[model samples]
Each structure stands twice: as structure tokens, then as C-alpha cells.
Target chain A: MTADHLESRRREIVLAALRCFAREGFHATSVRDVVRESGLSAGAVYSYFPSKAELVAGAVAPILEALTGVLDAVVLDGVRSVGEDRTPTEAVAEVLRRIYPIAVGGEVDYTRVAVTAWAEGLRDPAVRAIAERTYGTVRGRLTDRVTRWRDAGHLPADVDAGALGQVLLSTLLGFVLQHALLGDVDLDRYATAVALLLPRG
Target chain B: MTADHLESRRREIVLAALRCFAREGFHATSVRDVVRESGLSAGAVYSYFPSKAELVAGAVAPILEALTGVLDAVVLDGVRSVGEDRTPTEAVAEVLRRIYPIAVGGEVDYTRVAVTAWAEGLRDPAVRAIAERTYGTVRGRLTDRVTRWRDAGHLPADVDAGALGQVLLSTLLGFVLQHALLGDVDLDRYATAVALLLPRG
Candidate 1:
């Protein structure tokens, strides 16, 4: 195959592997499983990814990149809207609403893998690095937003922006876990509760 | 084996399966692996728990029971202190302090399995029954505490006790996930943040 054709094939195998991994898990999944899921022969699959870890890494890196993009957009939106007519809580909640869908969409698998990696990564260095990078980017973006709000006096004077960001991230993760466990369509009620958790001036 | 010895051997197999499942996952682990971990013959292991599902159920039921016991202690402590001289926030924090270790203990494997079961239970009726029983009891306890606080005017009139309990539960789960990921040792910080989320009188 041409280089471009090979690259496309690699992406196909990666996506298929993620679906299998999500349904089962990284360790439980085999090369044969990915081959069957991708409708590719064993040789064709081997041509793209060398190992299962490589396949997981390939699938996860892009999803993590996309999630970071979403988080960055949220932070940028908050910053751009800071000087606008809206209150800081409103801006923060608006950013949150933008983020809630990503957690439940294709990123649902991402969240699953991320949580698994977090627990398993304690022993697996390669997985741990990927998990840490993803978490750091997420936490960093949140800390920046909280810091801005604190500077604008949108929070209590003694508020620790760093810790508050941790709180917000923790809350968001909890909501996502609930969604993962319960297939509910009405998140508006939960969203309102989350909005209340934001620091109100 | 004697009946009592047989029962003890079965418990050993289930606990070993739990460790194996936690270290790997439900799908990655096999009956052989569990037996290897338990130092029992594979046939001996299966004689007690007929299937992996049964083994999983045996392993997790006690963890759920323990979790409910912790919730009961929290609610009972809150009720006992209801007539005592303490702020609502302080009382809630006290209960949280009593319950935080369950999130990050040696039994964390059981917690992981519980989480996995909770998510999978969404689609499986049999598993869902177990998940619902586990969640309902915890939610009921939390609802009781939040209701008590609201009636005592420790919470604002605008607060929904059920929603507040859900939020608290969500926050606790999220914190556990974060700490599991980051190796955070400070439950006190998390409990304090949760206290801040509750409505003040």
C-alpha cells in the first residue's frame, strides 16, 4: 500500500481496537480481537500496529488531544467573555455546559480508559505517563480559569484557586461517572446543581 | 472437604479472583489465573463458584455491604448529633471524615469492581439489580442526612435534598477517582470542599 493508504489503515485499526478495548479492556483484548473487529486479516492488522500497547496509545492520544482542544476552547471562551456583560459564574457555567457533552460522547470511552489508566498506571509506567499528561492538561486549564475568577474578586478572598479547580474537576468527573452508570437524558437538573457549586460573587 | 472447609475455600477463591480482577480486569482474568493466585486447584475453585460472574458477585457483595455500613455510620452519627451543638457544615464534614477511607483502602480492588459492575449493570438486568440495591441504600442514607439538615434550617429553603445528596455522592466518587489517579492523601481537603458545596443556613 501507498504511505497515505497505510496511514489511513493504521487509523482504522486504532479506532477498531479502541472499540474492542472499551467493550472489554486493554489486557483482555488481543490482536485477533482487533483483527476481527476491523474486518482485517491478522497480517493486515500487524502491518499497522506492532503491539496492543501501541494500538491503545494510538487510539488514546488523538482522543486526549481532542479533549484538550475542547478544554482549551472552554478556557478561551471564559477569558474572552470575562470583560463582557456576563458575571464570572455565568461565564464559568457556560464553559461547563460546553464541556458536559464531550464527556458523554465518543469521549465516553476516553473517560473509561482514563479512569482505568489512573488506577492501573500506578504499576504501568507507559500508561501512567499518558494518563498524567491528559490529567495535567485538564487540571491546568481549570486552575487557570479559577485563578482568573479569583483575581476578579468573583470568589471569596481566601479561596485557593488551585484547590477550587481540583474541586470543579472532581465534580465534573463525578457527574460523568454517574452518567456512565445511569443512562439518563435529563442532566439539566444535575447541571443546575453543578452551576450552584461555582463560586458566586 | 468438610462443608465449612468448602465454604472457606470458596471464599478464598473469590477473594483471589477479586485481586486478579482488580490487577487485571474481569475480561483479562481467567479461572486458571484466579486459582493460581489462590493456590487452589482450578477444579476446586469452580466447585464453589460455578462461573466468573458468580465469583465476581461473591467478591463484591461484601464490599457493597461494607460501603452501606459506612453510610449507615455517617447517617447515624448525623442523627445522633442532630440535637447536639454543631453547625450543619461541621456535622456533614464529620460524617465525610468517617467515610473517606473506603475510597482509598486496600479494599480498593473491590471498589474498582463495584464501579465496573455499576457501569456494566446499566445494560444488564441481573447486574443492574445489584447495582441499584447498592446505590439505593447509599443514596437513601445521603438523602436522609440532607433532609435532616434541610428540616433543621441548616440548609437554605431553596435546596433540594435529593439533588444535594446526589451532588454529595457525585463529589465523593469524583474525589476518589482523582485520588486513585493522583495518589492524593488528603481526604480532609476534599471533605472541606464538599462542605463548601452544601448550602449554609
Candidate 2:
């Protein structure tokens, strides 16, 4: 196979593995399950992913990408647009508004997979590393925004950006978990609560 | 065996099952694993929990009790003692203070088991029912507190108790998940954010 074809096949296998993990969970799923789900032979799947841990790591890549994309589009964009007479609080409220629907809607497969990843991280060091790295990236992005907000005089000078960043990420993760478990939570009160946290002029 | 003896044996099996679920992800664990961990005969384990689902349900009982205890001690007490010159925000901050140590410390088996429960809830109806019911109980308790706070003029009259209750519970669960995934997250910022949510006198 050409290099392009090899990459496509690997993507196919990883997607199948993610579906299996989302449906049956990481611990219950084996490599054979991924092969069966992908409709590919054992050799083909094995060539792409040597083990379940590697498959999990591969599957999580797109999820991390999607997460970073949300942060950029929703959060970072808000910060950049703050110069247009928009308070940081309004910017954050806008981000929460955008996130609520995606978290509670049909596009929640990523959240489901994330919950499974947390469980898998307990037993597998490789999965744990991915989970940690994903959170680290999220925290880093959030901390950067918080620092900018503080420097711009939207946040209090004494506030620790890193700590606040962790809290923000944790709140977002909490929303994902609640949506996955309870389904269709009305986010108005949550949005209001979060709005109260942001700096007011 | 006497009734008391039977009760103790059942408790032992449930504890063992919880340990296995925490260590080995719920989907990967079998009744056989519980038997091995409990050091009991298969017949004895089977006699207590008819199936893996029942064992899971049994294992979750203590978790529910602990959760309710926290609600009563931290949240309910906060409401009752509102006349003691304590703001609702201070009550919640106190609760967060109590919870932070437990969630990040070695006594975090409950949080680990909770992560497994979320994954298991996806494929198992029994587990889903338990998870939902548990959240329902939590929300109900939270709603009662929100209503009390509003009625007592601590919360705005226009605030919806059910909605605010869900948000509060979601934030708490988010804290648990974050602490479980990333140990010893400094909760000062989180507490501050939540304090911002409470009505200022």
C-alpha cells in the first residue's frame, strides 16, 4: 500500500476502535473486537495497532483535537474579540452557551469516549499518559487566556491563572459528565453560575 | 448463618467487588474476580450477589450512603444554620473544603469507582438505573436546599431551584472527576468561583 493508503487504513481502524470503546468500553474490548468492528482482518488491525492501549491512544487523538478546536473557537476567539467592547464575562458566557448544546446533543460520543478513557487510565499507564497530556493541553490553553484577561484588566491581579484555568477546565469536564449521565440538562442556570465567576467591569 | 453473620458476609463481598471495580474497570471484572478478591468460595459469593449486576448495585450502596452523609453534613447543615450569620456561600465553601481533602487523598476509592460506574452505565440498564437514581437523589436534595435558600432570601426569588441544583451537583461531580484524574488540584479557585455564584448580602 502507498503511504496515503496506509494512513487511511490506520484511521479506519482507530475510528472502529473508538466506536467499540464507546459502545462496549475499553476494558471489555479486545483487539479482535476492533478487527471485527472495522471489518478488517486481524493482521491488518494488528499492523496498525500493536495492542489495545495503542488503539486507545490513537482513538483519543481526534478527541483532543476536537477539544482544542472548541477552546480556540469558543474561548480564544472570545478573548480576541474582547477589544470590541465585549466584557470578558460576556465572552465566557458565550462560550458556555455554545458548549451546552454540543455536550447534551447527539454529538456527545466524544464525551462518552472520554468517560471510558478515565476508567481505562486507572489500569493502563499509556492511557493515563494520554489523559494527562490532554488535560495538560487544555489547562495550558485556559491558563493563557486567563493571563491575557488579567493583563487586560478583566481579571483580578491577585488571581492565579493556572489555578483558575484548572477550575474552568474542570467545570467544562463536569458539564460533559453530567450530560452523558443525565442527558439534556438545561444549561441556563449553569451559564448564569459561570457568568458570576467572570470579572465584571 | 445468623442474620447478622449473613449481613457481614454480604458487606465483605460488596467491599471486595468495589475494590475490583476500582482496580480493574467494571466491564472487565467478573463475579469470579470478586470471589478471588474476597477470598470466598464461588458458592458463597453467589449466595450473596446473584449476578455481577447485583454485586455492582450492592457495591454502590456505601457510596450512596457516603454521598448522602456529605449532603446532610455539609449542605443541609448549611441551610439549617443560615441564621447563625453564615452566608449560603460560606456554607458551600466549607463543604468544598471538606470534600477537597477526601477527593484528593488516599480515601478516593469512591471517586475511582464512580468513574467505572459511568462507563458501565452505558451498556448496562441496571447500572444506568442506579446511576440515574443516585443523581436524582442528589438533585432532589440540592433542589430542596436551593429552595430553602431562595425562600429565606439568600437566593434571588427568580432563581429556579431545580436548575441551580443541577448546576451545583454538576460542579461537585466535576471536582470529583478532576481530583481523581489529576491528584491534589488546588481547590481555592474553584471555591472562589462557587462563592461568586452565591447571592451577596
Per-residue CA lDDT of model 1 for B40-105, tens digit only, reads: 877888887787667767877766776677666556574655655344335446665765555446
The per-model DockQ list reads 0.34, 0.47
TM-score of chain A of each: 0.80, 0.82
Which candidate leads in DockQ?
2
lDDT of 2 by residue, A86-126 (tens): 44344455666765555435423767777888877877888
Taking all chains together, the TM-score of candidate 1 against the true structure is 0.78
What lDDT, from 0 to 1, does candidate 2 have?
0.73
The docking category that best describes candidate 1 is: acceptable
Candidate 2 reaches a DockQ of: 0.47
Highest lDDT scorer: 2
Model 1 residue runs over 4 Å out of place are: A1-11, A41-44, A76-96, A100-124, A154-160, A199-201, B1-14, B40-48, B76-96, B102-129, B147-163, B199-201
What do the candidate models score in CA lDDT, each in turn? Answer: 0.63, 0.73
